[model samples]
Target: MNIKFSGVLVGMVAVFAATSASASPRPDAGHYEWRAGTQAPGPRAPLAVARRVWVPAAIAMTDADVCQSMMTAKSGAMACCASHSS
Candidate 1:
């Protein structure tokens, strides 16, 4: 019985040590490769254009206009600009 218990304990310790060793994050986990002349393939172009155009337009727009637009788009539930009146 003692030999059997010792064998089980040793097996559990070995498994635990193996798992703990592999649980650590790799050193190059955050590294990314950026290649030249390669555009990111997605809806990123429309979003980028919108950011360059829409952001400045939105910033220049009145607070009331922005709040009304948000309310209309989001079913009249505007928690962010609720205090502003159009």
Candidate 2:
């Protein structure tokens, strides 16, 4: 019957989704050779928080930064970055 075939198809899809959801990947060991004389990469800083997006603090932005940031609109330079706004 069409109803029985549809029911079996839905049941198979549900079982497949449940099985796929439980297969999580293993975490990394985070091991490294600190004495190898090469510098290791440090933690990365995120670009955005809560609502505002910004350039990373480790990066040095120039005067052109304000122009680029406001490229989306004709707003004043005061609207560039809330953290640096006076």
Candidate 3:
């Protein structure tokens, strides 16, 4: 392509890109913001470090220990007082 035509082609592409960018919604408008102290609304929260400790113990758990450990894990959000039951 000729130099002038190449430059025009480049300019046309740049203009198209700028127009496309401006036509889209602001990027932040589609995002969710979480506030401090308020936990996200869900049936369950993501697992934390202390909670992960129960998995090995949970695998070894007897029928009696299942409900007890589950409540301990959920309520504390971590296993501070959870004594593993065999």
Candidate closest to the true structure, highest lDDT: 1
Runs in model 2 lying further than 4 Å from the true structure? 26-86
Q: How far is candidate 2 from the true structure (C-alpha RMSD, Å)?
A: 16.6
Better by TM-score, candidate 3 or 1 = 3
lDDT of 3 by residue, 8-79 (tens): 999999999999999975554444433344445566864332221111112333464555555545444534
Q: Candidate 3's C-alpha lDDT?
A: 0.54
Residue 43 displacement in candidate 3 (angstroms):
33
lDDT of each: 0.55, 0.54, 0.54
Candidate 1 residue runs with Cα over 4 Å from true position: 27-86
The sequence of per-residue lDDT tens digits that candidate 2 reaches over residues 1-86 is: 99999999999999999888766453232333323233445567343323333332343455766646663424433555545455
Tens digits of lDDT, candidate 1, 1-86: 99999999999999999999888776434444433443445975433222121111123344766656653435545644535434
The TM-score values for the models, in the order shown, are: 0.31, 0.30, 0.33
TM-score of 2: 0.30
Candidate 1, RMSD to the unseen true structure: 14.8
How many clashes in each candidate?
0, 0, 0
Cα error of candidate 3 at position 68, Å = 41
Cα shift from native, residue 1, model 3 (Å): 7.3
RMSD of each: 14.8, 16.6, 18.7
| CA lDDT, candidate 2, residue 79 | 51
